[model samples]
Target: MKKVALLVIVTFSVITTYGSIKSYNNLNISSGTMIAILIMIISLSIFLTLIIDRKTLKKRYIEKENELKHLNTELEETNIELESSYKKIEKLNSSILKILELSSFFSAPKLMERDFEKKVLDLALEIIEPAENGAIYLFDENNNAKMVFAKGYDYEKINELNLKKNDLIIPEKAEIIKDIHKINKNKMSPKKFAAFIKLGGNLKETLITPISFNNELFGIITLDIENNSPLKNYEDYHTKIMDYFGKTFAGFLKMLNFIKQEGKFHKDIALTLVKTLEYYDNYTRGHSERVANWASLIAEKMNLDKRKIEQIYWAGILHDIGKIFVPQSILNKAGKLSPEEFEKIKLHPTKGEELLKKVDGMEEISKIIRHHHERYDGKGYPDGLRGKNIPIESRILAVVDSFDAMISERPYKRSLTKDEAIYQLKRMTMKQFDGEVVRTFIDIIDNFNIK
Candidate 1:
């Protein structure tokens, strides 16, 4: 504005002087008109300059606004990326927690009440979303995949289509099918493909995962999703999770087998010890085996669980193991044991317990053996554990043991008739034996042949 104003003043001064000179010379134009024209030109020039400056300021402001908007867009995109990453992290954490829960569940012994394979499948279906149904195909003795457990599918139809190793298109770890109908014809055997399609007519997607450990395949797990499934996309994580579960189940089975073999090995050792005891005591040659059988039968009649019955059977076998420590002279004596000899005889239960407790997993059996002589009224043992204080297995052992002793011919006593033995058991019930156990035993043996 300053430069423009200065230039306008100089131009107007020159024009006014020229107009004055011309007017003086020829009297054609007046100096006053020239001055008025110069003023209008100056005013117009100032207005245009202001408009131009305003336009420049507006353009710069718009540029700055656009830069801010671009920055905000980038920040929003970054925030979205961060949010996605956080969600992924949360998902991973959830998966890890679920895996830990599975590890804990599979770690414990559920050998009695639960069908482990089916239970595992049920739990898997719960965590692995989009899976409407599943089946576990374990390899049978012939190395053929057999459907051991199934859910939400016709098990009989699937089982009829036995999946041989060569009939499968499953990857070593896992594979997913986007659409079951679109699966390549050559990927699986035609017979298997047709059977699968027939059995799973509504199935849209399938995830085939192998149960394996140390690269050795044990079985295959197949999970299905229907056409109307909630989640249509089978994510990478889903396959990973199923693969993890398959491997974990395989590991659990391996551990369970190891435990069973270990248990059998221990039982073998215990039976060997029983044989030694039987050899040392001729009067009780077949006593241990008979007691064990009768105890198991009584336990079964009482509806005890398989585990408890097995423990009772083993306890029966090992109950008299400590008699090996007793002097043969005292055992073969023709009369009743003297007080000192009786006291020594009473130590057998404790001695047997002490010996067996040293072995792993035999603590409960040792306890049963220790308290087998305990009376129902609390007056029949080294520990004198009374009634309910005694272990139920020990109480059962007492009934079977006393009845056998009454009927067996010993050095100083004649064998009682079956009727006499039943009377003795009845007379001793509630005093020396559990009334329920005694009743169960009598009922079982009434028609049972011991031979």
Candidate 2:
């Protein structure tokens, strides 16, 4: 409207300039007023255009600011979600690590023997934090419970614990709480409370978790509520962790028992073979055991690999297993043996290899036994493999075997003193044994003071 008005004013002024200039000059009107009116109309039109432009720019600026704010809000929400997801993933990773660490106890075939119950209790307490003390009770085939271990809590800890069948609270299913005051004194007695009483504390409520297998409860782990217990502010997340323990331990214990049974079977068989030697010659009683111990010391002194050490140890224990095949008369012979008798005795190493080779998983063990009697100079027996050609395990066994034989009293000769035995070992380093192995054995005997 202002532009149109300015146009109209300009048009009027132009017409007046031409039509009224001469008449105004006649009527006394000045040309300056016409120019001044044109300037006012143009200034008003320019000011109105500036006002419209400012409003449009301000509206666009506000719209852009609102859009930026919206984008920022969305980014903030996304950041919050990402942080939450990261925390969840972090927790999941931590849980997985804990499970794997616990599973390692099961993975090791040997570690689960002496400290099995203690390890289980420790892992359980870690998962179920602030626990005071606990006992792990394993049931026998007769469904009888025995407390195998107890640990944690200064006040409630037991240095030595033994739970009879009547003292345990084994359940037919998984459970979480046990009331000691309500338990039958004659059946599920709190016999373990006596140990804590000595520490000026008594038992209260117990959190019990039964380890079940094949629908039968085989074991129970119990955490206590004692004076020093810190389990007051327990959270809801502990349920899943404790449940995992019960189930995992149950499965692991079953497998662990199988390993133990297998190990015990091997020992029982080895002992049976040793007894045969003992029966034939009383001097051979515990000879294999001593040889094994000495071989282990030598292996450690040399810093042998763990697997190699285990192999050497077993080889030394069963080195003379073939003596059973030799005649009793030959083993017990006191005087110088006839050529036939010596030949029969030499067959022991071969007989041992044959006997053990038939068994499963004894391949390396049999090989070590076959070579234990071999000499470093390639003159020993069976294979006559020389120098480093002999297995490292066999070289280790030969040194300890000779050392043990020298120190041991035989029917044919007087036992050499430990010093005399050492001198003989040093004298025959290259001929009878590996020089490095013999040196390591000397260090073992000197450092460990085997006497």
Candidate 3:
């Protein structure tokens, strides 16, 4: 820009000097007019140079403004990305915390516990509108939305007040349609026996998010506010976010339930195996039931924890599974077994353990079966350890097993009287049964229903 200005100035100066000399020496025009003409030409050159400089200045100003605007746009975009990333980190941290909470109830949350639905609904409330009211409804086979979990305001409270679990006509705002996220609660909607949830008010804002997995609708969740609620508006983005999370949670629920279903399926298989015992020997079948039931009563009477009681119950039922491996001839033998046959009968416990160890989640049950025959005084077999060396469940099982065998009729003799069976158990307590377990068994047997 400076170089162009300088060149114009030098050329105009040279022309003015030459024109002055011409008028003074040889030209016909007056020196004054020639001077005016030279001045005018110089003025015109100065004006044109000023114009070019102004154009260059204007161009630079416009270019600078454009560059600043571009930078501003980039900054805005970067801010958006940073905000998005921060939210993702926060959400991930929250999910990890929730998973940790779930781990307390389930070793691995393969099935969704009831609290999971509430947690998800809480998140939905936070994302869209944090109302105190919310609920999760699962679709039954008939496609009716059945309320499984309820929050601030739901059918549960009605039943808590001695009302029906649900009103005959549920409020429109409380109901949810399958496969859509929507909200249309208003003053015009009618009210009903409204579960005493909101103190007393009408629906303010309601949002329902459908939980879908693999393009199939699983359930819906609804959150609403009472009249005079805080929020006045809802946004589309909130629905999108709720829908996305709803879908994610639904998939987790489905996957976990599958694990539960599989576990139940395994239990059915175990029971079927038990049924095979009945086919071969009704005495053993009936004996197994009585023992299982009586063992559960003893465990409960002993004030054992829930898990221990459950262990004893399942262990008692499956204890005789090893007997399946014993030859049917020996299992149903009408007379006392020969020594060789007795040894073969003793093998049943080990056989049961070996077969059942292959089943998932039944390791403890198998071990209990293996040790159920172990005597409290260390005379038991398969792996005889001393008193208190046997698994507690097995010790409990020994007393229950003996009591049931005595009270139940066998092919060899008529069953003992209940009182007589009690006397035998008490007589054998220290040597054949764990003393404490026997006492607990005695204490609870009368309360137990045998039939």
Candidate 4:
């Protein structure tokens, strides 16, 4: 539009100037007057066109330049967003891998505090990379944070500091101190502020994440990075990460508690069952306890692991639970039992196994109870598993069970001395008993002088 207007103005001026010059020459005007009038009209028209064109060009260039600048700014922002998203994805992947590793570690049947703390510290460092120092302060049973593990601190310096429970700062307190320093608040005492600053020690960047289980505060994990490179606008992100970690740790702690509780429950149940059986039979009152004690000793002598020892003890207590099915007449018969009655009595081991198999975590103990009567030479009844085929626990039970039976008075027979029982066990070695188990049992008795 501007170009068209300028073209029209120039054409009109050129025609007017030509007409004026011709009239002046025709009317006999002086040559000087004609020349001056033509020059003035031409110069005035050229000046007006130049002014319009310059203003139009300058306005167009300014508008175009502003559009380009806006586009460049938008492109720069998009690139920044893309870069931020990439970093987040990378952090997410790293977090996932760390969680998997932590899960595997915590899944073990047993977890020691020292080993667990090491794993926690390793994961903390991975999440807060480039940190100069790290510490895991676990809340003790009393709900107080105590530094359980630390990395990148001088042992001598730590000991010299002697930072007791009171001196150690809590998570809330640490956050307050950090907030105060961030805003440069001077209301706090200088001495106290200095001590707080010294605790963190030139590390302006610090992260404190709480470790909690079932809404119970378990501990806190803190990481420190270099001064002046502190994370910006990280409260929300840090909270989310900490919450995830806390929930995971809480799950592991719950599982551990459950395992411990289950173990105690099993022990308590075994003790109660033993007591019930003892109440039913006068001759066997306290008999299960003595057998369990002896069986555990024998197991230890044979170098069995602690879990196996526990199983052996529990099985010993319940080994005779099947005797409940036997008639009192037969069980307490003062005279020798007929062949039929003796055969009926021999079924107790199978009955005991069947009865105990219903209980969870008692399957192994049931198997031991079932095979307790089996002879090492395959002469015993109820499946006659011989020698090593018999579970070691059952073999140990057999030795202890027989020893307790001999030492306890019964309706059919009087009690034997410890020496006599030991002698009888030696005689039955390799036949009614595993020779190794019998040997260990005898050694246990001799060592403990239980007679």
Candidate closest to the true structure, highest lDDT: 1
| Model 2, residue pairs in steric clash | none
**Model 2 segments beyond 4 Å from truth?**
1-71, 101-249, 279-286, 289-314, 327-345, 357-364, 385-393, 403-422, 435-451
Query: Which ten residues in a row are the worst by lDDT in model 2?
Result: 154-163
Report the CA-based lDDT of candidate 3 relative to the real structure.
0.70
What ordering of candidates by TM-score runs from best to worst? 1, 3, 2, 4
Structure candidate 4, residue pairs in collision: none
lDDT of 4: 0.73
Q: Model 3, poorest ten-residue lDDT window?
A: 179-188
Model 3 per-residue lDDT tens digits across residues 1-451:
5747676676868686766678677556777977787777777777777877898889999999999999999999999999987876666566555534544534333233446666666656665544557777776556555566777654554334432222222332223332121122221123323334343246665666767678766676766665565555444444555555666666766766677787689779878988988887667767777788888878887788666777678788788888878889888887888999999989988998998889887888899999999998889988887798898889988888888888777787788887898889888888888999987877776686653
Count of backbone clashes for each model?
A: 0, 0, 2, 0
Q: What is the Cα-based TM-score of model 3?
A: 0.62
Question: Which digits, one per residue and each the tens of the lDDT, describe model 4 over residues 1-451?
Answer: 7656766877787688778778776688777876787677677767877888899999999999999999999999999999988887778678767877788878533353446777777786777555567777665665444566778654334434434333444453223124324432253356544654555456565666666666666666767665666553243454456557766876777777777787789778777776776666565677777778889888987889777887888887888888878777787788899999999889999998998898877888999999989899998879978899999998888888888888877767899998999899999999999899888877668655456
lDDT of 1: 0.80
- State the weakest 10-residue window (summed lDDT) of model 1: 105-114
Candidate 2: residue 264 Cα off by (Å): 2.0
TM-score computed on alpha carbons, candidate 4 = 0.60
lDDT of 1 by residue, 155-191 (tens): 7777787767656555788788767555535656787
> Alpha carbon lDDT of residue 99, candidate 4?
74
